[model samples]
Target: MRAILVLLIIVVLVAIAAIALGFVNVSQTRTASLPTISVKGGSAPAFNVQTANVSVGVENHVVQTPTVDVKKP
Candidate 1:
């Protein structure tokens, strides 16, 4: 039926959007960092950027980390 086809299309669109939004990753190390979530008004939610220092290679190594604002909503 047309209705079933439309429903399937909507589901596919949602799945594609989630994928494009980078919601799934096979490896945890591939994820740069996890955001810190805060609750407000007993229901509202917001995120604070999380960061980490990374060092790579041998002998000549480099360290890098992102600067995130510590503001809370």
Candidate 2:
């Protein structure tokens, strides 16, 4: 399996080199172009949206937290 993979990679590299060196010639016979599209002017539909009013507030609370002490020798 490994040998087969290596051989495949080598073949790909050689093909690429050949194409780069002009030993392989590739060309397109027919010319291609995109189709022309014409869009008519149209008005977009309007939207009437009613959103609810939201109120935001913050609350504070005091809690006792444990303190830790570390000693190094």
Q: Count clashes in each candidate, considering only residues at least 3 apart in sequence or on different chains.
A: 0, 0
- lDDT of each prediction vs. the true structure? 0.84, 0.99
Q: Candidate 1: what lDDT?
A: 0.84
Q: TM-score for all predictions?
A: 0.33, 0.47
Lowest lDDT block of 10, candidate 1: 24-33
Q: Write the per-residue lDDT of candidate 1 for residues 1-73, one digit (tens) a residue.
A: 9999999999999888888888854455564768999966665688999899898876966889899989888
Candidate with the greatest lDDT versus the true structure: 2
lDDT of 2 by residue, 1-73 (tens): 9999999999999999999999999999999999999999999999999999999999999999999999998
18 Cα displacement, candidate 1 (Å): 0.3
- For model 2, the superposed segments whose C-alpha errors exceed 4 Å read 31-58, 63-73
Candidate 2 lowest-lDDT run of ten: 35-44
